[model samples]
Target chain A: MAILELKDIHKSFQDNVVLDGINLSVNKGDIVGIVGPSGTGKSTLLRSINLLERPEQGEIRFEDITLNLPLKGKERKSVTALRKRIGMVFQKFYLFEHKTALQNVMEGLITVQKKPKKETEQIALDALEKVGLKAWKNHYPKHMSGGQQPRVAIARTLAMKPDIILLDEPTSALDPELVTEVLTTIKAIAEQGYTMLLVSHEMDFVSKISNRVLFLDGGKIIEDGTPEEVFRHPKSDRAKEFFDKMNKLKEPEFFI
Target chain B: MDTKFSDYFSVKLMWSRIPYLVKKIPITLELAGLAFLVSIVIGLLIAVIRYKKVKILSPIATAFLSLMRGTPMLIQLYVAYYGIPAILRIFNSWGANIDVNVIPKMVYAFFALGLYQAAFTSETFRAALESVDKGEIEAATAMGMTYGQVLRRIIVPEALENALPGICNSVIGLVKGTSLASTCGIIEITYQNQILAGRDYRYLEGYVALAIIYWIITIILEKIFKLVEKKFRIPEQPKTVEEV
Candidate 1:
């Protein structure tokens, strides 16, 4: 059974259509990777699922509730409540500059979840341990390297224990060496069978971690299949063209 | 103007008399401190109103900022201390029995100075709030934080750290502005010195003592604010120590 579904999702900014009627469904523990060229509305489609970018028209069913968009006060409250169970990791780390890694992870639990201070601290420490940031939990974001900072950011999201995680190019901004640490952490999370919808340009890492890969083109999903099927035998002309172009671009050493 | 200290220009007498003027420093401090606290609250309110651009209240806040900043503070003080009573008297004769002069002169000076400081500090607040990275706010929202939660957790804390230096400058300005309270008969440092100069005719001595007191206060305030700014400063980039 599908744990999350977006039916006929449509979005546009002004007269420019950013997303056409797009449909997708993810069963529990499914790691769905979205890969596409820039300006293809892949991020818009992922963001629309969480209602961060409201769809012009669509019904998104997550677990039980159908999200109401064009979000008003009551709808907004429900969205926020829903968001508590749906975590998002940004391309930029977005770790609070004022907070330490441990404090950053604990902030949501204390403020949103209303968890006890002692319990939140223990959980935050455990999350940091999982991300290999246990020793640096007390360090602030600016003081940490770009790669280490996203680990803290992931630790922060992971501590919330959300049912699904959305990652928008989690390592696109990192240095070459730094990307390995974050990709490793992401792969580890996938191994634990957590639900994730990842939008990334790292084709190799996406293929390695995602059970199913989706190719989005011109605001629509052009192809969807297992990673081996989509990458090795893309049927759609748009997908073939995208893969050919992406292949010509030099890849980092980690891709192999 | 004729010099009042020609006959009583004894340096020893001047040194001895300086202590008397120093006695009124507490009153000057009280006036500045209370007015500064009040100004900060009003300033934050004005900034939030203007920044949020509330339909009905934003324009009013803009007009208010202009009006406070446009007029001379001395004129504003005079209006609060003198004009308000006269207006109240007119209202009293029309059947209301409220006493116009019941409020103290110090209160009027505090009101005038605080309102003036708010005008300046609100601009500082707006600029600081706008400087916080927009990406941080979006990330906070995506984490399921309510708008109010995002503001309290992310926006205000960051903005306040950025606003400190300017706000401290305003606080120091307010301390200096407390000198004007003498005009309202508050008998603060400046007023007390003027009274001493009249009696002993050592006008230059009284004036010198008053200047030193203000100079000391400014130095002390600067040091205190410096410590505060450092406490809230963002920690510099993390230095890595290689782990074996």
Candidate 2:
């Protein structure tokens, strides 16, 4: 069964239609890559999945539960419960500047889970250890490199024990050399069976990590297939054009 | 004018009143300190109300802040010292019979200063609150902090850092403003000096003394505020994830 589903999702800002009649599904433990040219509602669609930016109209079902519709009283509690299980990582590393790297990771455990301070600290430390940031536990985000911060950000969400992680252009802000560290961390997490919905521009990384790749154009999915099928043979004209542009752009060394 | 100046220059006359005026410095400091505390509490509440924009309460807060800021501080002191007492007295005569003297001159000064300062302080707080990045707030909310927890844990600490310099300036402004309370019979440093000048005719010496006091207070407060600003500076750290 699909772990997450967006049915007939529609979104717009003012008169400009950003996403119209878009639908998607991600099965459990699947690494799904959403790729599109810039300004194709890629970011908008990602934000909508988390309900960060509310959809104008649609049904989002995460783990078999419908979202986006107004929840009343008891239903609100259930929606909040589901939210705690979904984690989001932003392109800019959105780490709390005021909090130390460990503290940022521990925050979800402490605040959302209401885990004991000592246990939360241990869990946070464990997550940071996985990201190789256990030594920088007390260091603030401003002091860290972009790649380090993004790793810490991922650690933060992971500390919450979320089943699904939504990554919004995770490596877009990193230095070329630093991108591997973050991408490697993400790849490790994907190998560990964490369902991830990634919006990224790295064609090589997209081809490697994604169990399924969805090609979006003009706010709609123009193509969807396994990485080999989509990258080697495009079914849609838009998908073909996108791959042509990707081929012209040089790949980073890690891809080789 | 020369004769008037000499009269003001009477060293003996001014020197005699120095101890009496000096004695009142504590009273002035106490009034300012109390008013500062009161203003912070009042300002915080007004800020919260205005920040939330709670129905009728927000409009009332809006009007109160507008009237407090729009009018002169001196006028506010008069209304607090005289107008409020007279109104209370009139109400007492109509059967309430409340003892107006229970509320001292210092109390009136506090109410005037705190209420007046709160208007400006709340605006400062509001602005400081706005300065916090919206993303941090969302992150905090996502972390499961309730609105109150976010305000206390995330919003307030950051806002205080942003609001500190403004608050420090206001405190100094409040200290200077305490001089207006002398008009209401609080007998603080400014009032005592003014009285000494009137009786001894050493206007220049008394006025000069007050100027020195204000100067000292400003210098001291400014240093304190600068230290506070330094302490709150955002920590800059080196990033992780060694170059791949």
Candidate 3:
């Protein structure tokens, strides 16, 4: 089933357009990998799905809710409801520096959902265990490794039990040595059939895990298909050029 | 100016007045404590108003801050205490039913001092709130928090932690500023010192005692803030986020 559908999404920053009339849909348990060069609105496209960057023109239909066109100003009630069902992992990790890893994951549950503390504590712990960070649950984000922090971030989202998660350059912020560990945790989550929209530079991992890969450039999706089809036989010249540059890009030097 | 330095500088006399000034310390503390609490309440409201840039109210909050920063505290106290009553009398002349005569002198002093504190602290709060990483806020919202939840669970806590040192400064400034209330007949520690000095003709000695007391209070406060600031410190490096 199409859990979330976006139609005619357009966004711009001043004269630089970011997303231009994006139309896409995510089905339940689908792992959609989005790949593009820097500054091509890959992150912006993902953010717009969560309404983090309000598109100038778009229609987002998630389950039964629909948000039409430009988001007036601040977030609306419907947007908040939509966001609850869609979590995001940022490139910067953006963990609350003051909160311990456990507290960080537990915060959204207690504050947003108002779940009882005792129950949420156990749930947060289970989420931490899933990311293999239950041992460091009491450690603050500032005290943890880059790989560990993103796993905790993933655990935070996992605890929220959102329908779909938007991972914006999830491993980009990690040191090369830590990338595989973070990716491993992500892979473990993907195995459980969590619907995810991933924006990533690690094409090998992207091509391996994603059932479908989207090639975006100049604020538009140039190609979208199963990894075998898109990576091996891209039709559009833009997607071909994008792949050419991506092929030439320096490989991430993971010291694993 | 002609008096000998030795004649006025008696450590014994200064020491004797400390006990006399000590009794009135509570009054000074109460005024500062109450005013500081009220100021934070007002300042948070004003800071959030200005931060969010609420339509007409943003300019109003800005104007209020400008007015407070522009005027001297002494002048503000005079207006609150002396000028308000005079304005009320003018209202009576215009056949208006208003009475500022019933208001207490301490109320005016408190009103002025609390407002003064707010003006200063509002900048601290606004800056702290702005200084929080924008990405953290987006992360909070993405996790399903509404604006109100994001504020209480995310923004306000971060702002307060960041604003701790500034809050300490504002608190100390307000405590020292309560000395101005002596002019309004509030009989706080400074007013008590004046009365004590009058009894023995020891102006310099009594003032010295007041200074020592204030110094000690400030030291105690600074120590407490140092402890809190230490606790509030974002860890420097036990383990780095970059190193696996």
lDDT string, candidate 2, A183-229, tens digits: 99999899999999899988899899988998888889888999998
Model 3, range B1-244, lDDT digits (tens) per residue? 6887668688888888899899999999999998998899999999999999999999999999999999999999988887778888898899988766677887888999999999999999999999988889989988878788889988998898889999999999988999999999999989998898888799998888898899899999999999998888766755322322
Query: lDDT tens string, model 1, A148-186?
Result: 988898988999998899999998998889999899999
lDDT of 3 at B104: 80
lDDT of each: 0.88, 0.83, 0.89
Instruction: Report per-candidate DockQ.
Output: 0.53, 0.34, 0.54
Q: Candidate 2 vs candidate 3: which has greater DockQ? A: 3
CAPRI docking class of candidate 3: medium
Q: In model 3, what lDDT does residue A169 have? A: 93
> Which candidate should be chosen as best, given DockQ against the real structure?
3
Note the residue pairs that clash in candidate 3. Answer: none
State the lDDT at B189 in candidate 2: 89
**Candidate 2 clashes between residue pairs 3 or more apart in a chain or in different chains:** A143-B237, A143-B238, A144-B239, A145-B239, B92-B97
Q: Global lDDT for candidate 2?
A: 0.83
TM-score of chain B of each: 0.91, 0.89, 0.91
Q: Model 1 chain B, poorest ten-residue lDDT window?
A: B235-244
After TM-score superposition, what is the CA distance of residue A20 in candidate 3 from its true location, in Å?
1.3
Compared with the true structure, what per-residue lDDT tens digits does model 3 show for residues A141-190? 87887788899999999999989989999898777889999998889889
